[model samples]
Target: MQKAVGIIAEYNPFHKGHEYQIQQAKEQTGANIAIILMSGDFVQRGTPAIFAKHQRTAMALLGGADIVFELPSFYACGSAEYFSSGAVSVFNALNSIDFLCFGSESGEIDTCRFLGKLLADEPKLYKEKLRSFLKQGLSFPAARKSALAEYLKEKDIPFSEDFLDTPNNILGIEYCKSLAAQNSSIAPVTIKRIGSSYHETSLSSEYPSASAIRRELIAAWNTQKFLSDTLKNAQPPAVKDYLCALLENETFLIEDDFSLLLKYELMKNTPESLCAFSDMSPDLARRIYHHLNTFETFTQFAEQLKTKELTYTRICRALLHVLLNIPSDLPAISPAYVRLLGFKKESSSFLRILQKNSDIPIITKAADYKKLLPKEVHSLFEKDLFASNLYETVKCNKKSTAFTNDLQKPPIIL
Candidate 1:
């Protein structure tokens, strides 16, 4: 039987770093097939993907993934904990996977497992210390780190204080925690991230961060220099060609494109109403309500809302939930179904094994939800559909093209 490894990612624009990760995952795990669980139209950072999901899916397939599954919008635009839990749950539901591979700065699976186990266990001392830090007005991430450090100190556990600082390491820890919490059989694997840091904004290295790539792409688009050599070198050949085609067609989207929609969402809702959306606390909702008059653009408003306790990405995600109408009382964790976005034609037998092993429905056609999902599951799936339609509407309006329903589109098979 063919072995498979699962990867959870956004692949916002599918760069060379991502291609390398997929290649290394297969090589390290000795897996015959790689399955990707990717974010849809929206990414975790509360921004629309630069290119559409299907385009990214094609890039993933070309980059070496056997099959690609869409992580629903609710989790896609959620915090690291929710994002990891939802993704892990989906992979767990797919019983054929042998391993879950992720890229991390630490690249220490044992350390990640230790931290994950500590967090999942949540001992009394850790809880007390965490609460104390929170009461001192520290942000959740800060509080958790401080609490964990203090708890480890008292327990005499050897660890590094900087492990929680890097984005990839933090996410990797969350993945480990999720796997532990679910008591999953799938083994966790980590590959060290190469080249630029996650937040690096300069395109000077052979493998630039996605952030740097996005910045370069946006700058090039604004200046009408669509085919820069620096940008070309940062991506895989297929992704480079796809990006060029998208640029030529003027089909790419950016954070500012949804400003009008966000403004409308803010204008109509009171602070109380806004608090109903996921990640919208009472304080944040009130702040957003007061800041409505000064709102200029999505990025600008997120900047305006930034504070010591609330990060810019958190604010953007909260505002996105408001715009998308994601409820605060939605399920705590777990995805409803596995929505296939694309696949390589040669992976048919592997796909069959996955289908036979999966516990939840694998949705290939958007229109067959009624037959494939339960009532409550269909309700959750509807949010994914609405998000896709909303994204399509924005893209179409920007391009001056007719609106096409996302449900009518078929999964990409290459």
Candidate 2:
């Protein structure tokens, strides 16, 4: 069996930095194949991906990933814990995956692993401290960080909360925790993120953040232009056209893209009914309902609803959940299938190995999904299908073209 390295990513635009990570993972693990578990049409920050999933998958294969699998919308649109666990579960189910490669600000795999164990175990002292912190009105992330820092201090353990503070590091920690919880054999490889913070909105010659690129691309589109020379130089050669088309055609989807539709959904349904969404608290639902008529866009509404307790992103995500009608009570189950988005031509043998050894079904064709998946699995899959359709509607509406339905989209083969 050949060693295979797995990467969990959004690839929101398949930038140069992502290509660098793929190359580094292959070299560091000495793996024969690189597998990417990517978010589908929707992404974790409560927004649609800049390019369609198929375009992103093609870019991944062109950038050297051997196989690309979809992280379904249910998990793709979730919080860090759920998103990481979902991707890790898919990797764990694969028979040949050996190492999980991820980027982190700390670039310390051992520290991530230790913290993962602590989180998975949740010692009594840690839990007590966590409750105490939450009672003080800190957000979940802040509360957890404080509790962990306090616990580490009392135990005289040498650790840094920097991992918890940085976005990629926090996700890396969740990946490790998921691995520990599942008692999986996959080893973790950490690559230190080079240049620019995750949220930095400025371009860097070496490695601009994804947020920065998206902002620049959108700005360029709004000005009826394409990427400038410097920005173009920073993109992978393969995705340049995709990026250009997305911007030129105005197909880019942001959290604010669904503003009108979300407002309609909120106005049409009772505030109490929205409590069935995962992120919507009763108070939060009422707040959104109260401001539904005042704000013209989801961004405006989210900002109006924001406070020290509610971050803008959190409010956006919650509104998305409500708009999509995500069940307040999603069943707790590992992802039930692997949906291939694309793959390199040379990776045929690896697919065979997965088909033979994977516990979950590998779905390559959308039409076959219904026949092959069980009732519960099919139900879960419907959410992803609905999300894709909604995303297509947004794209077509933007371009004023006929719908390019995803049901007819065959997996892209490079």
Candidate 3:
């Protein structure tokens, strides 16, 4: 059987544990090709990815993936459902991806499937139970577990472990649901994460978590040897260079951009407008408005106010929406074209697969996007353009790349 596995990842810094997951995916699925569909400039946690798409793609290819593709930014920054949905849809289009591999604390699929069915088919009663649990002061995860227990009490469904403790497993279930909902042919596989926890700050062995790895990198300027194997194993594209680029060029400065726009938006925001920002619960928005004057930096404001139920990531996402003018829900749209990041000669086969079936243009140049897209997409394209230029500035000493349309392609820097 010929099986090709697809992965959706954000290797903010590639690590060893990630390598173990890829190895397990291939071993379990008997897959030869590992296709990674990853976030671009930003990650799921609503921060700039430690590195840009081009660098990340290069690292993914080195790590083990046979091919790398960009997950659209809209889907990349949204909820788990949208993030997984957007990624799954792209894999679905490829036609060759037969398995979807992800990391989960619980390596069991049967329990995930059961929970998924309930979440989708039994929305109202389940939601109400969950809401009731939350009103009693349970955290979201705790409330969810309590609600699930109540829903499954009459039945014999076995929740193998403390489900609330497993973040990857929760997300893994989301992936299963996405695959099933889309009716995609991809089979789901979960590799149990090893070594450190997802959000752990301390490092022990070669396979340190991404959080630990990021901290190490941020503290020290060195990368080559200092990078943990867990991250180096994944081969996240030249991250040190990227971060330096961002710092030097002031890419982190949000003035005149989304963050500034958001500051203005928040001051003028009506309760009703705040309500439209999805995760901004009615109560939370009121708190934000009441507390906006209390903090200075966005991170400071978010960290001081949020509860465990509303994670720092979720709070940052909500803030991003206010700044970027992203609507609560995004409509599905074609990529306009498949833009190449970095690919080894081996990626030729992968490109062939996409080019053969891709619905829109497959572009290697940023300049070509204007001709292919409508004016509305310009704002979206401009962000990407800025991201690309900013990313390039990080990789090279001098600014050697064009911000707008340049037909000349960047050589695949291995």
**Number of colliding residue pairs in each model:** 0, 0, 8
lDDT of 1 at 390: 90
**Which lDDT tens digits does candidate 2 get at residues 361-414?**
999998788988998778888888888889889888878978867778899898
Tell me the whole-model lDDT of each prediction, alpha carbons only.
Answer: 0.89, 0.84, 0.66
Ranking by lDDT: 1, 2, 3
TM-score of each: 0.98, 0.96, 0.80
Please give, for residues 97-135, the per-residue lDDT of candidate 1 as tens digits: 899999999899999998998898899999999999999
Q: What is the alpha-carbon lDDT of model 3 when measured against the actual structure? A: 0.66
Best by lDDT, which number? Answer: 1
Tens-place lDDT digits, model 3, residues 156-254: 556544875667878887787777777767888788788788888877655678778666665544343343444443333453344444445422212
Backbone clashes in model 2:
0
lDDT of 2: 0.84
Better of 1 and 2 by TM-score: 1
Off by over 4 Å in 2: 245-250
